[model samples]
Target: MSPMLDPRRLTPRPIPHLPEISKRFDGVVNCSDDTNIEGWKKLLRDDRPMKLAAGSISVVEIESKVLTTGFLEFDFVVEGTGDAPEIQILCAESYENDMDKGQPRSKDDRTNFRTGKLYGPTDTYFCNTKLSRNHYEPFWWRTFRYLRISVSCPPTSSLIFNSITYRSTHYPLPITTSVSSTDLVDKLHSTSVNTLLNCMHETHEDCPYYEQSQFAMDTRSQLLFSYTISHSDLLARKTIHEFYASRRDDGLLETHFPNPGRGMNIPQFSLYWIFMLQDHMIHFHDLALVKRYIGTADGILDHFAGRLNEKGLVGKFEVEGTWAFVDWVGEWFTPVKGFSSMGVPKAYYEKGAATVNSLVYALALKSAAEMCTALGRNDTTTEYLERAESIIQAVNEHCYDVKNGIYLDGPGATGQYSQHVQIFAVLADAVNGEAARTLMRRTIRERETLGLAKASFAMSFYLFRAAVKAGIYEEVWEELLSPWKKMLDQNLTTWAESESMVRSDCHGWSATPMYEIMREIVGVKSGWNETKIIPRVDLVNEMRGSFVVAGGDTVDVSWGESKQVKLKASKDMEVELVLRATSIHIKLLQGEEQCFSWT
Candidate 1:
């Protein structure tokens, strides 16, 4: 099915033309204005061109209020000439030191351009000494908060810098959601939106810098977050189709689609593709789209089912050139005898099955079963559920640590514990009710003391899910968000790849707060074609927000001290309100505002 045929799909919007918020110029001469910075400002404000004399080398730096992705554009005029001048445009998320060592530098002041140096991708343009009215713009989009344009001219040529502007580009997603709460929550929400914007271009990239490959796991979370703020699913649909096209002969997906290098696969990431398919079904309700990929889901599950060991738990991927990555916990960075480690748990190398992998398979089976049921394939649905149940049962029996009241990384692998196993245990239904709640509670409380490897930014999404399932989201809300809060405190304009902050500083996987804030704090949950509002009244006294529902309608909600809710919808639909252990159903008429209050 062509995604463009969908009536509900939003049309792409035009990219905006933006001027820099601030500018700085160094070593600039022969301008009409008194100072170089003033000259640049006049060029932006009054359309006056800044002229540079011959034999001058100058740097012009510009800053945006936040991170942005765009095309750098400028016009230049060269009059008297000997040799063509060279201009280089450099973009960076932040200025830093010791970039070669991969060390984390203090970036608390992103606007302090003079303190540090810019380190990122650069584009160079050599001007024509004889040509006039030269317009320069790179073909590829550049992501940055700070941009520097350096111009060097020979002694015989004078250069004229006419104008500089940024033609900002994104997926053209209109943000239909808003959150009005504490300062921290507000900043986190806005920062998350910026981070997601930067990571989204032609595909959902892990980060704008370093590697822009679309990994299944990262794309899954990014799609969910996108659904909460915007009704447009064109990008999501494209991603699903691309991943489906990237399926290998063995029924597993490549680690990241559109990869031109050697073939690589991560067994767990294929399972994430199943989760992505199910997520699409829930938000968009496109049965045709799901039907097209349902067989592919089966192919993936079948491969994992064939790999189950004697204990009924899914074993590690033994295929050559495959990585069994679970999480990026520091303790999981085990050194191999002949090769470098990639943060794979030591238990995976030991003699037993990894609980995280088995649990992830079980979860994917459950998701696939839901899609099958939606497609009216009852037999396939039952088979998938049964398969999932068996894996959950096997994990509970073999991987559970009875004495410690925790699940080990693998069967009989003593002292092997991690937050990933426990998070998945609750998600895959290896445990339930109070047991699940208690397990998650203990997992969070004793993680440091028990030496349990913590979940990084990517796995934290599941960590938050497990918390919500255990009904402890309100209780541990602030604690679970400490990582994001720390990032905010560190003056990070975008989310970091991990708490270590050594790699990419703008990873979309770290934008989980965008989803969590909308779903949990504001309490807008997607239910097929309906909307569920279950605001966390206990934690938040008053809040107001709006988000797009499955039916391509905007639902606005506001609640405050009177325990009153004011809701408005664009179409006639059923809005379910759950408050203080009571469920109330209300019929919201089209184009009418409804108010409900609880004692």
Candidate 2:
């Protein structure tokens, strides 16, 4: 059986007062100011309650000042001669235009309450008592920045709005790490942390809103983000085991776990599950943990191995019920007259092998080989490495577009190129060194002109990795982060699901900047056996932060424009400092500070 799930301890916090309020009605209301409603103010005070007449509607908007996940509580009393009154509560991360005007509404200022409107799932309640205080609270917690409540009474009844409050809830994971730099970077870091917090609870949810499912692809990135801030692997371990339990008879794992009903399967997500297992092995360095899931990893790889086509590459998933989701590119969502699949490229619908699917399978094989090497299983390691290399060679031989100087979406896929295939090609080692760098540079620079399919927020984590591997991270940093900067520019307190901003406003996958900021900007790279401090001095002049490494040890690093560097470790450990072209290896003693200058 899987490990016992950890119990969550949530604390209830009071919302002192409402931030902003607006009302539209057709009936009488008792208030000091007709233009300005003081009824909400009465909820805070115990003296006199805000009274609403029959048919009167009041929309009280409350801003928590930050993104939060929690249950809402409100107390009120009813006095009337007719039927019970109805209360409606709507929650949203931000306000938007009531109607889509065929333009990007995400660019509009979210703080201007008068111009935008709030839209989200609404919960309603009916008051039954005549003169006694009635309390109302929802069964499930909601994720929101804005909470709008409207109370309407019958022809003779009225509602005395006594008080309203909300109890904030989370997984109780304390963030011990910290990083700071320019205003934008700092905001990006803090906002990313908030977004991650909102998505994490009993399981690593894709988002607290909409579907609170623990998707494999989303959980992999989220687990890495958790490792940067907090050292506790309780949630990560639980998630890994749960996904392993979701395996089917065909050896393919379900896309998400804890799904009670008929589960959906995404072929690529099963590959991501192996990545999650490898990630746990890297951060925690627990051999027993790796051994436990290594069989499950092999089973998943074996399933893909059996599906290789005549060209020696993993073929398209023709299973009766499965999705081959690579990324959420707008070009892939085009409607086909007879095809049922949407949000996937046309090549995926055809009978050929997809370059992205084969590349991901190859990447997973390499990851599994690393785990096998750790366990001293040389034979298994050799088998996985050889299989991975063969798939990489097959993809290079069949999918490379000589004319465009890039990899195609699939074999014989003319004029169908995407950043996804290119990113995976570099990651899976199908291309390396100068070839990889040149291809990535072209992909980033000419994506718009070439009409290449772009990677949305969910796929950006891999996009950043490909850039780093190509040695062009600093060159394309600004362009890569423009989407997030746009969200901040639009006054978003949390990350949106995608650039489209049509769905969830708080997807944890979009919180990948937290991982990149810590790993790349802070330059604290922790591996399975060693910790490396290689600050990208070119990115920022000065930076400082501490992160939890393997075995629950803390490493602190700080550097400035003077080229002076100071670092310390919580215990005796081996550390490597990469300063430009030179590498200095040192041993850090417990609580001892190591000082040096790069110059």
Clashing pairs in 2: none
The positional error of residue 399 in candidate 2, measured at the CA in angstroms, is: 0.5
Going through the candidates in the order shown, the clash numbers are 0, 0
Give the per-residue lDDT of model 1 (tens digit) for 1-599: 56756478574543332233322222222222346877777776665898988888888766766777777778889977588888888888876654466765645544445456677768888887668778897877777777777888899887898877767776667777877877777888999998998888778899987788899999999999888898778888889988898888889888799789646578889999999999888888889999999989999999999889999998867657877777777677657522323666677778557889999999999999999999999999999999999999999899999999999998888898999999999999899899999999988988987778889999999999999998888888889999888878767789989864466779999999999888987788976767788877777777777677876687888888878878888788898988766788989888788877777
Residue-by-residue lDDT tens digits, candidate 2, 538-598: 7777777777777777888888877877888988999998878578999999999988787
Error of 2 at 178 (Å): 1.4
The residue pairs that clash in candidate 1, if any, are none
64 in model 2: Cα distance from truth in Å? 1.7
Question: Model-by-model lDDT, in order?
Answer: 0.82, 0.81
- What TM-score would each prediction reach against the true structure? 0.90, 0.91
